[model samples]
Target: MVRELFNSIAKRYDLVNRLTTLGLDKRWRRKACEIALTYVDVKKPRILDVACGTGDMIMCMRKRLERRGIPAKFYGLDCSERMLEIAKKKVPFAELKVGNAEEILFPDGSFDLVSVAFGLRNFSDREKAIGEIHRVLKRRGILLILEFSRSESLLGKLTWFYTRSVVPIIGGILTGNREAYNHLWRSIETFPSPEELSMEFEKRGFKVLTMEWFFPRIAFVMVLEKV
Candidate 1:
């Protein structure tokens, strides 16, 4: 279901994201990459992006690393072929493949860093995916997750209302797929809080390095290190 929904919106995925999030999605991706950069000590790091829709995260990380003259190899995995098609064009240099996060097709300790931006909630088995990520990351390697969070503040309530009621309408008007946007709200509504998600990672032998919340605390970027 998630794969089909993404495939349906692959053409307008970037545009709808920009419109609904007011382009802050790009900033969030950049922020995640920046956090990943700080912990990277290797001369040439190997990075893998799981559920790398349209390769936005890969592109952001590549550009930032290039600016600092840090060379790195990139790989991307996504379940939707249509989304991968768009991602290939965006990050042509990266090795992009069609695969599931729960069963990543990589050798043990294959990556220095693994990133999933706004994609964790869509995973059918998040815990399994976390274990697979842990299996593929070298000791002390980084895993960055940027995802929506449930907040109780007043601003958070307003943001929730907008996401639940207004976002679907805008997305429907733009993409002609209101059900897909509805699933977006449902996913965010049911996803675990930042604290809860951190605990999940911790249980999987990951130590939380940082938990940074965006405006209104409706979303967050979590940096974890495999222990």
Candidate 2:
């Protein structure tokens, strides 16, 4: 279901993101990459990005690494082929595979860093997916996640309303698929809170390092380290 939904909207996925987030997602992705880069060794860092829609995270990290004169390997995994196809164009240097997040197909301790953006909430098995992420990371490896969380402030509430109403409509008009956009809103509303996600990370042998809200409290970036 999720794969089909993403495939349906793959053509306009980036557009919908820009429309929904008002282009602030690029800033958030940069921050996520920056946080992940802190733990990455400049010599030869191996990075994995799960559900890496359009490879924005990979591109962000790649640009940052290039600026610092560092060499790195990046792998992107996503279930949707169309999304991966688009990602391939954006990240020609990345090795992208069509794979499941719950069962990352890498050897143990294969990556120095792992990151996911706006994709966790759609996972059918969040715990298994997180465990797979932990399994693939080297000891003390860093994991960065960017996700939407329900906010309590008035501005957040207003933003939520706008997203709930506008996201599906704009997405539907662009993609000719309203149901997919509806699922997007529903998933965000049903996703667990930050406190709960922190506990989930701890259960999967990750210690919460830092958590910060961005985009007017509509979304968050979480940094965790494998214990």
Candidate 3:
């Protein structure tokens, strides 16, 4: 069901993101990549970007690597081939595949760094997926996760209302799938909080080393290291 939902909106994923965020998403993606880079040296980082829909985050990081003539061994994976097809265009130089995160096929310790941006909320078995992340990452490899956090401030409250309601309406009009947008909004509400995420990572032998906030209200980028 989720696969069909994402496939249905593959063509408009980029547009909906920009329109719904009012153009702030590009900066957000850049910040996500920036957060990912901090845990690993960018000159030659082996990155695995799971649930990499449309590949904006991978492309964002690749551009940073291009400045110094360093290339990233970036792999972008998603469950929806339709989305992967769209991502291929966005990240032409990187590997893009329709694959499940809970059963990553790579050999153990295959990647030096792993990251997921705004997609963890959709996982049906987040714990299993985290285990897969732990298994595929090299010992002490970095895990960069950019996810939605709760914002209790008045500004945050207002933003939340708009994001939950207005964003979906606009997204529905643009993509003809209001329910999909609503599901995205609901995912935020159901996702684990920062504290919960830290505890979960630690329970699975990962250490939370960096927790960054773009806004105190809800969105954050947390960087961890596999133990």
Candidate 2: tens digits of C-alpha lDDT, residues 114-219: 9999999988899899989999999999899999988888988988898789888988998899899899779889988888999989987999988888877888
The per-residue C-alpha lDDT of model 1 at residue 192 equals: 89
Each candidate's clash count: 0, 0, 3
TM-score of every model? 0.98, 0.97, 0.95
Weakest ten-residue segment in model 2 by summed lDDT: 33-42
lDDT of 3: 0.84
Clashing pairs in 3: 149-218, 150-217, 151-217
Q: Give the clash total for candidate 3.
A: 3
For this target, which candidate reaches the highest TM-score against the unseen true structure? 1
**lDDT scores of the candidates, listed in order:** 0.93, 0.90, 0.84
The RMSD of every model to the true structure, in order and in angstroms, is 0.8, 1.0, 1.5
The runs of at least 3 residues in candidate 3 whose Cα sits more than 4 Å from the true structure, single-residue gaps closed, are none
Off by over 4 Å in 1: none
Q: Which candidate order results from sorting by TM-score in descending order?
A: 1, 2, 3
Instruction: Identify the superior model by lDDT, candidate 1 or candidate 3.
Output: 1
- lDDT by residue (100-198, candidate 3, tens digit) is 888898999988888888878888788999999999999989998888866777877877898898988988999899999998878888777788889
Please provide the root mean square deviation of candidate 2 (C-alpha atoms, Å): 1.0
The whole-model C-alpha lDDT of candidate 1 against the native structure comes to 0.93
How are the candidates ranked when ordered by lDDT, highest leading?
1, 2, 3
